[model samples]
Target chain A: MARRSILGLFSDPDTTANAMDALRGAGYKDWELDILSGAPYPEGTFGEHMPSHHLFKFPLIGAACGLAVAILLTAGTQLAYPVVTGGKPILAIPAMAIICYEGTMLGAILFTVFGIIFESRLPRPRVGIYDKRITEGYIGIVVTSDETRVVQAEKTLKMAGAIEIKSGA
Target chain B: MHNGHNGEALAASPEEVTQDILRKHREFTPRFKALVAVLAVLFLLGVVGFIIRLQDGFEHRVKWGYYAAVVVYLLTTAQAAPMVAIAPRLAKANWRRPVSRAAEMFGVVGLFNLLLFIPLLFLLPSTEGRRTIWFDGPSMSPHIWDTLAMVFLVLCGLAMLWAGSLPDMAAARDHSSGRRQGLFAKLAMGWRGTDLQWFLIRHRIGALASLYFMFLVFTHFLIASDFVLGLVPGWKDSIFPAFQALSALQSSIATMLVTMFVLRKWCGYERYIGLEQFWALSKLLLATSLLWFYFWWSGFIIFWYGRQPVEQNVISLIISGPYLPIFFTTFILNFIIPLVLLIWNAVRRSILGPTVVGCSILVGTFFDRIRLYVSAFSIEDVTAHALTVVPPAHTPDIADILIIIGALSGAGLSYALATKVFPVVNIWEIKEYMLLRVQAAFHRMEVTILAKPE
Candidate 1:
């Protein structure tokens, strides 16, 4: 009873979404299917849960870390080697505040890219079922199911007018 | 370009749109060549002016802080190009599709801004006993903050542009051949257009756009504080940074409008960059212009009402001094011209009217910068904050004129080159908008509905 990964291609999003809804109605779990398109297709078009993303926290974390680093660079260095000037304190608050702001933004920007890379899980081995036509305005619906549900999925895809289908080991 | 997103595809297919864009990118017309050549000559003259000024030494060069101010203003205003790309996206404005890439490409001009700022570092007055922010420390100076802010802004702008353009790069990679294909493919970052990739790109764009918006305001604040406010004697206006930020917005909007007009007229992109884009942008320009006046009035009224001799001296130096004409011209161009022209619905809805208003604002902003920096730099009070009642104002020399021409050319040339390399229109964004936008009948009237499916 080996599970099969079937990639059904549709010419438009409506057919693809209908196919997905049909598959779900046939008792397939949300995790068993994925959708792919060239442009960013609106989420939930395929009647499945959108994959949750944790990339939002990266900026917040990076901002806090940046603020700390700014403190060390502006305050720590000044305290270690005090150079009095214009009756200003060794640790100038305004200058340090500017430095802190810069550091926070720097960290946020850096970590955001990192978060995207991590969450996308890019550069992974192309293990799942896929299609090249998806890049040329075709919609792809990838469904993985047990042997019994394979026929049901195929029927659902055909009824929904899948232009093509491919099976992956 | 106006396609019903949810129902039938608009007048053209995605493939056809892509072909149209690709054709435009490949063809570099004679008109484009002539424009670039003119800008190039102007830039060279400015460079020669800079060289001569540098050779004349700091004593003489200090007088040319006005030259530095001109360069800084032009370069800083060029940043509005990227803001044009980012702001519309954040607001989900459908009309932004055709022009976002053009706007984003201007971010590269920040490189020239950084290079032009190097000489200004040497020209800055020392901060030994002066009430400046540069604390005495090894390798610590106000220049560091300015440099850091400039570098960060440039990087953020570039990064945001790159992220937004990746899907388009992949599209190009799929359809091109030879070296172009290879380049696009590499830049595409191995995109296969999976749901995961799309999701990540959306979030990444949001993060970068937010960061860029924050940086735009913050960096302008730093530039205003370190360069202009810090130099002027007895000029302790808390609202100065807000004023400068508003001015940047106004100037940037003007620049964006001018660029859009050029693209639509010369590039034969009339159908794409139509009245809708101009109409939306004109309203924004009007709003920013009003805000700009409010901030200026706030600062001016405070100084005017105080009537303290020091504050009065500051006012005369700015408003009624030798730079009197420039001050008045700035008000007329930035505020009066725009206010008069843009208030009419007919003008705001038309291309010619907004373009005229935009040009006026740009000219006004240039003179405004001159008034701010020239008067402040000329005030050479090193101790006890003695305000100069009548600051010496000299007309621009040959070198000053050349430098200004060169800075203007430099910004134009860099943006033209960028357009050549990158797609001037965001094809992917256009496609996405096509998918999401629909025409519907509401209240027995035909209307457009933009669906946000999450």
Candidate 2:
């Protein structure tokens, strides 16, 4: 059984939501369906599955790593050089604080960017089964299933008011 | 009693918005080409001036004072312009939708600023025996650290710009043809407008914006402390860096306003950018203008009241001495002028009034930088406990004048080129703005209902 991708484009948000419902009602799994739109539609606008992400942890880990590195660098340099200025302590915590703060921020920012790229699954080698109309205010319900199931999915989409349906393997 | 003139409503369909915005790429008018040509010529002249100045090298810090002023001017204005976009977005302001891309487009100037900054690194003396944030950290402390901070700030700015423009890039990729389509496609990174992608991009933009703010403040602090305060002994004003950052905030709003006005007036984008944006930003501009005076006063009053020998010299060197004229101009242009003009509700609500104030602030900021950097750089002895003698105001030489013109032109050129690459107004954000709001009849009046999504 060959699996193919079917895209049902709708101009109206209500129609898109109805198509999503019809696809699910016609035995399509949530995993096999994806919704695309020009603007960021609020989650569950189409009654679609909301995926959870762990984006928060990336910055925490990065900040911790940066702080550890900064502490070591500041403390290690002080210990190695052991310069006494006006009988201040070897590790001048106050002086090190600025660099430490900057380092932590830099790490957090870099990792947050990385986390976005990773979490978003970006740099996608190809935009599979996409419609140019989706970038022009159209909502697309993309269904990837076996050929036999795709026909039923197309019927469901049309019956639920999809303006156009596109098929690709 | 509502103002009926909010320009035209965004009544265009999403596809129409995309086509209208992208149309600028195809229809590069003679005026635009002439503008680009003029900027390119000026930038080339700036390069020539740079070459002429390079002949002097880092041996004479005074000679490079104007150059330093230009660099900091760009830093505080162009580089800081993105904050207009960032701050409003963080607050979820509705009026920022059309002009957000205009603000973010200034990030492209950061690359040029970075290049101009490289020469100053050599011009800046070592932190040895000087009171600096670095203290006794390392031999190359300020140099290495400042460079790192600058690089990080520039990268963050570019990343924020790219992240904010990602969806627009996808629109460009879809609507464009030939080489442009290829470029936009690569830039878009196969963006398919999936739910997950949109979610991640939003988060990324927020995080980058937050970080850019922090980095901007830190960079201002470092530059102020190292380049200016550290050079003049017995001038330890903690509020100086904050003053610098605050003035930057004020100037950045002005920069955004000026750019927006240009887009609306000249670029035929009046339908998208309107009195609403100008009016909203005018209030902020007025607030920052008042705060600008407050910060300057907060720093100045200390020196004025204390009247110590060191504080007196510092004042004389910076304020009442040879730079007195420049100081007065800076004060009036940056504070008094904006205050007097923008204080009125009529003026604040009008497009021309804010744009004029913006121009005034820009000129004021330029003179302000000249007053600060040139005066600091004129100091012959960095190791002196206090300024024994005040150096006369260093006027711009031929090269300095050329560099100033060139630097300003370069920033403009970068922005104009970027407009061609990315849509001048954001496509998706504008569409989102439309989707989230509706005009409803309320009694005999109409009201706009805006949706706020968490």
Candidate 3:
């Protein structure tokens, strides 16, 4: 069975919410439908399922790696040269603090950026049943189902007052 | 929802706001072009000045002091401008929506600042036999670390700018055609405003904003320590770098206020940016102005009370000696004026008052940099334990003046060019702001009820 996507555009948020409810009532799971809008409405605005994410883990991992690297570099350089300065011992923790701080921050920033792109599913190869009008303040409810169920999904969308319906394989 | 004075509503429907902002964004008027042309010419002159000054070479460090001052001035002012958006957004302030992009757009100037910084690196003397934080490190310790910090800061800034503008790029991609459409499509990276994408964008922005703030403070610490304090003997003040960072915060807010005023007064963005934004920012400006005095006093009081011979020399060189007039000017402009003016409700709550204070602080910061950097650079020997004699003030030559004008103009030009690529007012933020607020009657008064999303 080939899956197809159906996008129903609505001018009003209420109608969009109704369309989501209609889809839910018609045996389509929350994972099968997604809402797109111009503005970032709060999560669950259209009664959509909120997906869990692991963005917080990236920074912690990065910081640990960075701290480890910084400690090694600082301690390694001090031990290699083994020069006493201001009567301070080699492998001075105080001396290495600044570099360590900067390293941790730098690593966290880089990893967080990578995490955003990965988690966002960015550089998506295909837009998939997207309507340009969605960026012009229209609300789009997109449903992904088998070809046999496309007609039923389109019927539910029309009954909920969708102004336009776009379908794609 | 109506602003009352201009007969313009503060809130508009999403579609109306999108079309209106995008329409203004696409327009390339004669005035805007002329402004860019003038800045370009001035920038070219600054380049010529730079080349002419390069002929003198790095041996004469004094000649390059004013140039260093200009770079630090740009660093404190324009490069720090992104905080105006970052700080408020972190606080979840709704008033920041309209002016957020304007603040972030200043990050584009960081590239020009980095270019200007390369020459200063060569001009800086090696740290051998000098008092520095890097006690027993490699020969290129400070230089390598300084360059990395700057590169990291610039990267963080640009990344934050790009991440914040993703949704707007999507809007541009959908609405545009031809080369612009292609360019925006690439920049958009196929953004579709999915729920997951939005959640990721918000988290990314938060993370980047936090990172940018940390990097900004760290960079200021490095520059203040290595570029100025490290060069000037017997000027060991831990508070100095924090003071510079504080001033950067103050100056960045001032920069945003001035930019907001210009956009409202000239760019026909009065509807989006208004008194509410100005009024909200003015309070922060007031708080920073007070802190400016506290930080200056906190640093100055140590030397003033101690009166050690070396401390006295440091004081005379920067404060009581040849640069006394410049010091007074800086004091009045950066502290006295803002404190007096912003203390008043009438001045602090209005658009023009903050703009006026912002201009004052900008000029004050310029002289402040000159007072610090030029004086530090004029010292005869970096290896000396204490200043033996206070060197006379090194006045700006024509080349110095050109560099200052050119560097500032270059920053302005970069920001102007960025506007043509991205909308100055963030479309989605403004729509979200309007979405979360509604006017309701409270007894005899109409007040706005704001909702915070979890």
Which prediction has the highest DockQ against the true structure? 3
lDDT of 2 by residue, B273-364 (tens): 88889999999999999999899999999999999999999999899999999999999999999999998999999999999999999999
Error of 1 at B267 (Å): 1.2
lDDT tens per residue, model 3, B369-410: 999999998987998888778899999999998898899999
Q: Quote the positional error of residue B95 for candidate 2 in Å.
A: 0.3
C-alpha RMSD between model 2 and the true structure: 1.7
- Report the CAPRI category for model 3: medium
Query: How high is the lDDT of residue B109 in model 2?
Result: 92
Which portions of model 3 show Cα errors greater than 4 Å?
B4-9
lDDT of 3 by residue, A1-169 (tens): 8889999999988889989999999999988898889899889889999877888888778778888888889998888889887788887887899889888987887788788778878877676779999888899999999897888999999999999999887
| Distance from true location, Cα of B450 in model 3, Å | 1.6
lDDT of 3: 0.88
How close is every model to the real structure, measured as TM-score? 0.89, 0.97, 0.98
lDDT by residue (tens digit), candidate 1, B1-454: 2431212324567766766776777677998899889999889998899897777877643468668778668655788567777888888777777778887777788777778877777766666545554545333366777778778788888877787887777777677789987777677767777777787888888788889888888888877876777777667888988888888888887888898899888886665677777788899999999998899999999989999887888788878878889999999999999999999999998989999998999989899888887777776654347575556786787888888889888888988887866788888887888777766888977777788775
Give the native contact fraction of candidate 2: 0.67
Query: By DockQ, highest first, what's the ranking?
Result: 3, 2, 1
Residue range A42-144, candidate 2, lDDT tens digits: 7788988887787887878888888888898888999998989978888888889878987887788778778877887878878788999888888999999
